[model samples]
Target: MNVLKDVATGVGLVLATPVHMLGRLVSNVWWPLKGVKDEIVLITGGGSGIGKGMALKFADLGATVVIWDVNKKGADAVVAEIREKHGQDRAHAYAIDITDREKVYALAKQVKREVGAVTILVNNAGIVTGKPFLEADDSKMVKTMEVNTIAHFWTTKAFLPDMLEKNHGHIVTVASSAGKVGVASLADYCASKFGAVGFDESIRFELRKMGKTGVHTTCVCPFFIDTGMFEGAKTKVPWLLPILKPELVVDRTIRAIRMNQATVAIPRFLYFGQFLQGILPPSISDAIVDLFGANDSMDDFIGRTKKD
Candidate 1:
């Protein structure tokens, strides 16, 4: 009976796959986007880079925006810009270290009191130590894990309860292509991102199982962006794998949030590459990676000096 059930499930999936794909394609292209005008969006690392860009975009869309960063000045500048274009009450800035779980919880409560229950949470702040594993500083590695992976837990916990109560919210995880595939010279960074990607997926499944289908989760996995955070990073074949731009990533991310996309791989080619990497033998996969010169792309690393 169990074997029959397995065969039945397989047959059902085979029949459903094409229809699912076509429905997804059509919905992505033609579905009316969900509105965010009534939302209160909180974005970590909103001081600069993609975080700043997303803040401005969300404010432009008429959502109240909150910016959190260790760099208070940068967060304030972004808030000021949003106010100038939108309205005085359209944006707010808060400076806090997301790595501190207790502080994060405290600030979250303050945000709720000052602004409102956060309806959209964007976990975007991350740091990278572009050094070989043996050469990487122990402190920097711990910092990287705290910011990239562990902070997600703190931030999500701080905001997710409200989402569960209402069953109407969005969580955007700004991970990296490094989260999906390993690259040379980024051992610490890659491990942190892998954790982040896993975190997002697990939470998504948990939410669905709890029947909170309206609470959407999007895990954004983009290749290195031109955001100075990954300065000097390069690809041997630009046509096949060009470095992404912050603007492009921001736009796609917003769209994905509206459409409630589960996982968004920028350039779309990443999906194919990941599929191949999964099915191919280790030796062949390593050879392909070596041929593309991906592992050596960080040989001349000059990442941003300041955190976002």
Candidate 2:
């Protein structure tokens, strides 16, 4: 009876999968955003680039936005701008070294006391070293991992308690396309992003196992954006994998969050690319990457400054 019941359930879900997906698609189109507006959204690395762009959008939607960045001046400027445009209480900024776990915890406590429990945590802080594997220094590689991957671990540890307590919150991880597929000249970045994608998937499963269904997570993997971080990178196939724009990335990201999507690949083509990677032989995958110039996209890399 147990085996029969289990098989029946499996068959039911398999049969219903398309219907369920279609319903979800309709809901996404019809539903007004169910989050934000009175929620406190904390965005790490919110000084510039994608983080800053997301901060503005969150503030526009009436979420009290808290920005954490190593650059005090840039964070403060963004906070001031958001306040000026969206009213004084709509935004706040903190000079936080996200790489430091202790500081993350301490500031999280302060944020809870001051700004209220953060309901939306965006692990947006990231760094990249565009040097090839052998050419990249130890510090650069370490910093890349610390900022892009380890910071996700720390920030989630800090803010996730309140979220779990209420069983209502959202976590967003801004990873990269490198997380899905390997790339030359960005070995460290690829590793860190892959780690992030894995982490997000694991935690999401943990949440489900714990019956915390209300808490949602989204992992965003975008292609190269003109955000100064991947400054001189180029895509050989513009039609297939053109460099993403910051605004477009943020827009898609916000939509994903609003709809409670698990993971989203920018431009949507990467979904097929990931599918190809899964079944193709290693040699064929490598040949495809070489043909697409993804392996050499970072040949002329000039990444952002340390302070940025």
User: Best by lDDT, which number?
Assistant: 1
Note the clash tally of each candidate: 0, 0
Local lDDT at 215 for model 2: 94
Q: After superposition, how far is residue 74 of candidate 1 from its true place, in Å?
A: 0.8
Model 2 residue 282 CA deviation in Å: 1.3
Tens digits of per-residue lDDT for model 1 on 114-191? 999999999999999999999999999999999999999999999999999999999999999999999999999999
lDDT of 1 at 177: 94
lDDT per residue (tens digit) for residues 58-110 in model 2: 99888999999998898899999999999988899999889999999999999
Off by more than 4 A, model 2: 1-17, 20-29, 305-308
The whole-model C-alpha lDDT of candidate 1 against the native structure comes to 0.94
